[model samples]
Target: MSKMQPKIISTLKAYSKDQFFKDLTAGLIVAIIALPLSIALAISSGVTPEKGLYTAIIAGFFVSLLGGSRVQIGGPTGAFMVIVYGIVAEFGVAGLTIATIMAGIIMVLMGFLKLGAVIKYIPHPITTGFTSGIALVIFSSQIKDFLGLKIGEVPAAFIEKWAVYLKGIGTFDPMTLAVGGLALGIILLWPKVNRKIPGALIALIVTSALVKILNLDIATIGSKFGEISSALPKLTVPEFDLVYIQMLLPAAFTIAILGSIESLLSAVVSDGMIGGKHRSNMELVGQGVANIMSGLFGGIPATGAIARTVANVKNGGRTPVAGIVHSIALLLILVVFMPLAKMIPLTALAAILIVVAYNMSEWREFKSLLKSPKSDVLVLLITFFLTVLVDLVVAIEVGMVLAAFLFMKRMSEATQVNIEDFDASEEKDGVPVEVHRFDSVDLIKVYEINGPFFFGAADKFISALGELGEKTDILVIRMRHVPIMDATALHGFKRMIEICQRQKTKLIISGIQDQPYKVLEKAGLIDVIGEDHFFTSAVEAVDYANKSVKAHKSGIDSRVL
Candidate 1:
């Protein structure tokens, strides 16, 4: 049993023949489904349709074979459309390829360092916010093709894109609208007819056949981008230079982060669906390999496509073999049926992307989050707006910073520091007690602190200690409720003890837990105070204070005589 136990390399073994048949069928189904969507995503990203196919065939295969998740399907997805479009606009195809390859290497290193778990800490609001924002961008991009508007170039900026679409409103073609409507109709209704054959394929075939039969003057793939090649993709290296690498690093990091988050999230979602677990680090490495290979073949960045992966699992895909087969099926279609893809109308492809946008928006979650804690809602809205109006890299960076600040705010609000008058309160009952007092002044100082003594809260704790007067002889700090501490807090605490030592006052620590006690010892707090000065309770601490006062009085009398 131990020998057969699952490990990273062991899980790579191929499935049995019968299992392979199931996987093949499921993979073929997903591949057919991936085809139209990939083409749509590529066009939406301002790239050729074939690049999407190359991504599906090359990146999609490698990710499944090497990824942590058993059944995640990797390909061009709606999530990457915004970032890829931005990169292409700013740096061109060669630049995009180099950035993707670099991002892939970063992902592989992240997996090696076991940074998979850290990715989960990204706030949920930020994810939902950016996802919905991207959906809006994609939905907007489809307007030109969906309406068959005579717009030459769409602006890349979110606001500018809409402004251009408005200007071109008069150029709307009714025939294009009819085709988009028909395609949408088939997509929405075809599921009721058959699940094995995808709705997208049906929509594309019907739309193409109708357009051809009617001799419609609509824009097709061939009209816009010419015929796609039937041959397999050849290996190509992106033009690489130090300047180019430096320029593309930020974009590459953004791609890496987005891919890591999306892929890991998809794997987790798949795990829930199939009652299986995924090795997250392994999955990161697989995603990295996919991107690197995709770049080598002149393909765009790829990640685990949630929709296709869910479709694979729903259709009896139980192993990574299913994902591999999906890639092979796409390769076969690219080889034999590339010419047929030319017949697909641009309007039909636009309609498919509209559906993709709708799924990506997740507006329901956005609305629900409005009623959540204000901090999270702020993060969500900030991330959403930034992603739409500015750039994804900026959105992620600002969103993370804002989320951290909000987290600290919540923690600070929860923390409390108080000066307890132990003499007047709960100890009035008939319980064993130790009397401690100052000889000159009848005062006992008891400090109560509640919360983590980490760096953020350290200053606040130290400031509270400043309220003590010079006449005070005994200072007892109670840390019974503090669960953790950091070097900054310990340093601040040591300073407060030194202040007491100079004023002829004694410092006593009460209620030290094992963890904090070890921490204090390691920081030399035990040696500073002497071990006998520490006590288990406030009563013991006060008892030691009283004894010290008596000893001080005797020394004062001896000096006077």
Candidate 2:
């Protein structure tokens, strides 16, 4: 196959002025949608709000420049809230920077190795479980800001967060709750009022103005994090030790895998809307580069955002130009209006995130999964509970293991072993038809093995073979129904052959499929059984066996037995 290429080069080949204008409009629109989200997600991830804008500007621009999707918008996402918060809690901001950079390198390797499509194998149940769990965590994180609770350094654990929140009930400020409630109501109603301007921006502007004009006593961004810088991001390497890198490996891997999955899934969803196919591997590489730039410039890890991408598509965006325009729009906002960001009530951002969590919760999917098969339900519950109770890394690891074991159990159940007479079909017809019938048919035993012979079913095959009586003069193992075999099953087959050899029973392996035949040929099992002992059909093998036994009985060649 030819090597993959970025979508921008291909897209520009047919670029037009009309397309540019459409892209520009859509890009500006998505930027409005992304601005508040980037800040909220950063705060949720335990970082300064400006870092979110930095990621939206840097990662957002490069993903479109080098990405395989025409309209994918990259930035810190809600999905990373729990993970990033946990990392910051345990290892601090420097550790998070190191982990993000490491994850970027791993993502690049994954792209180079063409593993983008492979990550799609993560089960639906696991994703649903973890995603819903993340939404809950995000909602929980925003509660302190939403209620303006007077609490110091809230804990990361879910139960503990609630316990602390419960204790701080008396400290809830009425004015802050009103600001949050008004901002949420404005966001919900502004779309119907006017579609040209984004609701979040209007909500943010109105709430900040109300807080400033009314002289309300509430926590603002400046009040908490101090006035954030409006200047461009500076490049600086974070302090890291070898021990830190080793300790951060697991978190980095989790980041890489989740980032890849989220980006490709967004690309796929956008592709369906626009009737365009995205190059998965190329998309991963673009995301990797974006993340690397983000970390280098004091930002967090990022990926393609489904909400922003869809907004781009709906706003007439059909090229990478739109995504680039979106990033430029954010940068312009950061440079021009960042001073005003200081006045934005923390309650408003918290309310915005609460809305985000509610939208992304996937509670309906979670309920539907509970009604699925027991195995699926088991994986879903385990992953969900683990994510809420333990950590994201542990939840994913255990969920995958449980899914694999359940899959093996189902495969074993589907596999079957049957022993049927050679002429069973002919006897049912009760007609004298020309067919391969073995001599001394009663003494000939046919063991038909069915199913893919893999690790789980190897023991089942061996157990069935162990029941083969020693008195059989000729044995034919029919394997046409067996789809494939692995190293373990090949070993089991060799052991079965050894047993037959010791019994001096003539052995013929018939109707072997292509995959199993290739495996046996590579293992030299075919040569060990002799070429003449293999046949295309069970009837042909029976005929050959019948002829050989008759020849040995008639003293033509005693060795034929």
Candidate 3:
């Protein structure tokens, strides 16, 4: 129950006036950065721009107050844009809301279960793969806006999307192109001129100003979606339907997964920056709650935004107060200046997303991955193409499976078997004698098998054991190097024991410890061979074998006529 709730009730202190000033500056900057992005992302996601502000206000505030990270800023992110757009298109806002709520509940449950540590288990390569793929998808989705191309219906598949894009190359909106290009230029170049102000906000302001003053025949948000609302969102519930729920489940799952990944990644990044550890499960729960609230209030899906989190850190924002302040700033702007938002151009928002897609691609990492081993490269490429062409869910499932299979293969290959002449004969007639001219009466042969005894190497072990000659009095199976045993090897061990019993020879186990010993004990190998026959070392087994052989010889001598 404690795990389900926030660990600390009160907020951390900023410690200095300078820190407070920095927090205020940083909060304002991040809010400025978030404003255009929230609206642009909302537009891209097939929702109203005001809903985006609503999300940044309500969801962003709650996430910070209850979140694990000290500086994480939660809101609508590009990661959810594709999935959210699909959900809204198919199931409408009501269905999307319900799905988001369902996902939120799942996240709460995940937090209570304390699955924070489990985030580490998600492979780095897999995350990079899907992230890069989503980047490509975002980039592709924006081609229509960037080039102002007109296509009747864009295909969802990657190959088809490109085909449609290529077909519409002739019909480009020149004014739209100019606006997008200029916006991209400002966003890229603004940081060099001023470090404090966000580039995206600058681009939005400049581009919107130009479009309005010049009276360019370009598509503006107001022209397309009408005037922006200036009031806070009213709480509402989605009309529940089994079919809509079923239809939106995939989108919901994508949001949930992407949210988990992004939020955890953001938390990790902030942890590194602030020298503090974050509760991953708690962060996930916060994101879930944020998203649920955002949906109920007619907003888009929200998660921890990496850029905003970094901004918060850089600005000396040491506590959740900065995050709360950021929400307040957005709320103030939404309520006071929503009328002015109508003047923003759609091409400007599209340009923002175009920049977003470029950043998200992580092309440098993609190039580095090209040099990785074949297994990793394959998984990466497969996930990338699947995300761009097929669906995020499909890409994730296939990538995970491939990664797991490759991991198991590597583990299996570590186990090995070796064969050697344990029992030898004298050079009788130049033949390495059929039976060993033993220096000791023990006549115990030792064969050492190393590595895990999984199915991969079980066959080799069985074949090696099968080669034992009939003259052998006893075989000492040395497994000091073996670390693990699986059912397949256990079955092989049973067969080996039976073969020894049938040949009227004793089978002794030596150097068994840890997992091998436990498995052997559970499999009844010790019971069948008699616990006394199992030795801690090969020398002990040999000594036992010698004693048994001497006793047998004495018994035989007694029976002689």
Candidate 4:
């Protein structure tokens, strides 16, 4: 029952041979699906193809062994492609290793600190915006390979990258484009023919065979990054100084936040499919360990892949065993089939990544979000544009701040302060009746506050009280509808008390809720305003104020006599 317990440990208690067989089948299928994707994502991320397999093998194995979700299949995913590529470009692979390890540490800390639930609150618009932006960026990054453009290193900036692509448009190799087209066509159309087999795998095999048989002069994995390594590279500690750590800290935080979001989202999706609950904190811990191991093993950053996890669930995978099998199966493919990867055309991988970009784009969601409220639309568009035109870090940072301010504005509008006059007449049993009409009604002012009294609404509270006339004998604040209060609202109340004291006016509070009462009591405002002046009902407080005013007037008359 502990939140830190891995789902594998719980599921294994009731495990059966039948379920193990099912898990095995599903795992092998997922591994097939992951193969071309892992290679393509790695190449797209500015790393060698073998590194992607390293991530899938190392990170995937650990995630399955220790994850909180029964069917979460973890590995290198397209969502991380943009950020990972940026880190690799800026700091090189060594820098990326350090950042990834640092990110893993942060994730572990987040899990232990019970911050898993908080990460889910990231605004949907921001997620969608950046995702769509990243998709476009990924698409842009692959243009060189997709077209076989004779270009040197592509620029990192979005605009500059496109400019370079345009300049080299004349140098595109027709054979390479044909290979990419064939791969893209197979990927898009293969599901209709055979749903069980992964389209990317078929495309990889068909395109590679065709290119080799024809002896096309297209750039292949071997031509660009050399042969894929069949063996895992020795684990090495990333060398770093304080300057690199400080410079990479923000990048590391980005990776942690992004990885946590993607992995938890995957776990949640898998949980729904299987009608199971996942330990979110434990999932974070698992992902943390996986990423740390991935970095040590010369792998790119990794997280739970939603598509693969969904495939696992649909293929009868009911436990983490399937995920574990997926990793093992991929490793076997790496050690046995890695040499064949050398002949796979780069254009085919580019086509696969293009599909990835399309899936990641979420264009329909982006369009729907455009029709949302203007504030939401603003946040979405700004985040999207900033993500494409600038850095993802800047986009997320600005979007969060903008969303927070807009949220405060909406909350301020929702909170209301109404000046109430108890002068209305009502009919009782066909007879006219007066409700709380008193002689000193004009002297007693009542302001009823509605909604939470927080910093957002504090100014409104003060301004509402400013409407009081100089001749007011008493001020009563009705807080029945106020569910909570914050320090800012308490400060406003203190200032109100000061004004009442200056005007020699009696202050009374009525219908205060428990939360606001505690807030006032903690701030010593209750004592400052006199506890005797507080009432449970507005009518009772008004009656007490009337009597007090009458007694004060009588005292004035006697002194004059």
Candidate 5:
């Protein structure tokens, strides 16, 4: 009922043996699915494949045990590949460890500060733009291993990486190419044959065995990276100097933001599938806790994986037990099958990742978004190019800023003010000759304003106010449509009032909406202008001003005067 109650607690309160059996089956399925993907992500991120397994085992367990969503399965996902690789390129594995731990701390602070809801305000165009860009980068990265090209470490830039890879095309191993293609074919075709067993696991096993028994001349995990430590991850805190910590802050922030977005997106998808709602703040806290634990255990940044979460939902996983079981299954596999993992061919992992990248690319959505509104298209392109040519950190920042500016432009366009000649407008509508005869002709000025009076529209509205005629004895402003106002606009309004007062003109504001009315009240503008000056209707304000003007003409405004 409270923060103390994780979703797991509620689910387990109604737990049964039947649910356990279903959870166990679902967990095993997800673990098999997670194994190859985790290893691939780790290698792409410039870490040993075993660290991916550790993340799946450690982070996966804690996320399910403490997370706010029922079906979210947390682990190493494709989103981190670019950022993790860049961090590793600049600062070694120790530096990465420090960044991950600091990122974990930042996430925890965000959760505690109730910043999860705030993260939702991050625009969708920016997310989609970066996602597609990452997908392209990932796909390009796999080109070297997929073709078994003997290229030295490829440059991080997209074009540069391709140039390096293209130069080494002559060194492609025929046997490795065959293995990668065969693995890809098996994965693409396996799902139609059977849904219970995963295509990835089958591809990994068959490809690894083929390479081993055939004595194929190809690079493998063992040959390239050497033997992976089969032992459990031990507790070791990475020492960091202040200089390095400061250097890693940008990288850490990137990880935290990306992890939070990915995890919450997965959680939201799971919620839709299960007809349930997730506690967003609690989920953030849970993910933060999971990342902290994962880093401590020598693992990379981990978050809820949408693919795994969906698989869990489809396989009768109704509660957190499925995620827990998935973690346990991975742990058992790591311990028992640690030796066999080394025999896995690099090309085979590359094949699996190529497929992963293709699916993650979301090219269809990218193309469609290009045909969208001009602002959206601009944001998409800026984010896309920046992600490929520069870095993810810059892409997100610039995209957000660009989107904000476009949004302000639209808001300003919607807000408008028009100064109408009271006599002319009344005459055109055939209502005013009689009214003007009774009230006073060309003596009162009316300004009509519509939409929000935020900062963007402040200057224009202020300029228009200063253009009021010197002959104006009374100024009536129609604000029935102004839904909101900020300090800048309020200041503009006060200045306008001051000018009217200096010219010895009375200002009457009519039909202001509730919010702006309250704002003016709070700013003491209402009292300064006199509460009697505000009228509930335009007609009333105009009538009151007419009476005052008439009184002034007769030298009867005040006896003291």
Candidate 6:
């Protein structure tokens, strides 16, 4: 089957009634689990609660209908909280919609270009750093609502936000804090009673009812954002301006990259749980379509929700049908029960988000990574601090560049150039053995390159060759272990050839691997140096060099006679 084929198409060919029942059950359960989560995540992302349901309903439907994973549950997640909040704060909801649509387009292009596999190469330390940083930022953002601080507008900057929170400490409402604590306690303890009914939902119901019954002097969703709309989201086309596009392009790219990483990671995790494979490229395409539809429907950005996906798998969701059902179930809730969402206390939502932040923190991973190599630790620290203190875009950009340079440094260190002499003694079976030395061994110099010949190691190769004395009659380069060579290394070889020609020294290359040989052949280096001088092994090259030296001496003798 093609990699672009969605998993649903294949599964439905053999779909059974029994499996359909299982899918339905799992889907309804996952929908229940996703209810409070979707709303809480939307609020945390600086959007109205209804947008979260819109994302779950629209994006979730498309993702399941077109996705490559059997059990992927697409919806708004905590991962986007920081970036989405920033986008909404800077450019408003309209700007966020445009950016999300742009990101979706980028993701589609990436899938078509077959860059799915390339995304896996993003370093773990960078992911861990940014995730933990985002967690911290999210936790800080929720502090206002959690403590019921009477702040009109919270600053987006991390430090400034904390300063504002500190200044409003005196305005903290005890009633709101009590409601938040009750919700948190329910979420943390509800699993022991009944795991199927999500703790978040239970907390949402209990806290909303308590707050409404008591008429607590606290801010509820209704009081702040007004009535929750039960009607289906209408399609919205954001006004596109060149200035806004240019200003928001970076933000769009950030969303695309982050969404890709999170969705693919969730797919991989689900694949392991179900013993199935997911088409990564197809998954990207599905997520792209989902996000585009989400943005069009006035929804926040969406991706595969890891917690929800796991819940699906655990509940016997073995096919994409379950995912589709999940979206349908959410839609029903949106149309029927959305009006009650207004009574939910803001502090309860804040508590749910705080739990989300804790789960996504990856604090243990961060602590473990600090004990890694110094270079890795440096990248982690820089990425972490930059993400917290600066923009996520800057953190990811700088982290990638720094990781690339550090990787090159490590590879260069691995690329070894060892000088070999045929006159050196050898050992056989732990006993000293006499090695056959060529007659012109003193005149022949050999250097063996034992790793990838790339730009990082090109200068090292040239410097190693420079160490050869001027009296050399022939230079043999052994490249048996060099699996690959880049253009810079090829240029270095050209320079070496020039030096050999200047000194009237014969150049012989031996044991070139297939890839490096093809590179040299394509660059016309083989023709420039003559194919006859190339050998399959260093021994052959050394033998040829010795014979050439003897022939030269004989020609001189004959001329003298």
RMSD, candidate 4, Å: 3.3
Model 6: which ten-residue window has the lowest total lDDT? 552-561
Candidate 6 Cα lDDT to native: 0.90
Q: What is the Cα-based TM-score of model 5?
A: 0.94
Give the TM-score (vs. native) of candidate 1. Answer: 0.92
Report backbone clashes per prediction. 1, 0, 1, 0, 0, 0
Model 5 clash number: 0
TM-score for candidate 2, please give it: 0.96
Tell me how far the alpha carbon of residue 67 in candidate 1 is from the true structure, in angstroms, after superposition.
0.8
For candidate 1, which ten residues in a row score worst on lDDT?
Answer: 1-10
Superior by lDDT: candidate 2 or candidate 4: 4
Tens digits of per-residue lDDT for model 4, 275-377: 9989999988999999999999999889999999999999999999999999999988989999899999999999999999999999999999999999999
TM-score of 4: 0.95
- Candidate 6 residue-wise lDDT at 49: 93
Give the lDDT of residue 86 in candidate 4.
89
The TM-scores, one per candidate, come to 0.92, 0.96, 0.88, 0.95, 0.94, 0.96
Q: Which ten residues in a row have the lowest lDDT in candidate 5?
A: 425-434
Question: Candidate 1 lDDT, tens digit per residue, 188-288?
Answer: 99999998898989999999999999999999999988878778988998668999999889889989999999999999999999998888888898999
RMSD of each: 3.8, 2.7, 5.8, 3.3, 3.4, 2.8
User: Considering lDDT, where higher is better, how would the candidates rank from best to worst?
Assistant: 6, 4, 2, 5, 1, 3
Error of 3 at 461 (Å): 3.9
lDDT per residue as tens, model 5, 102-181: 88889888877878788888887889889988988998988888888877778899989888887888988888899999
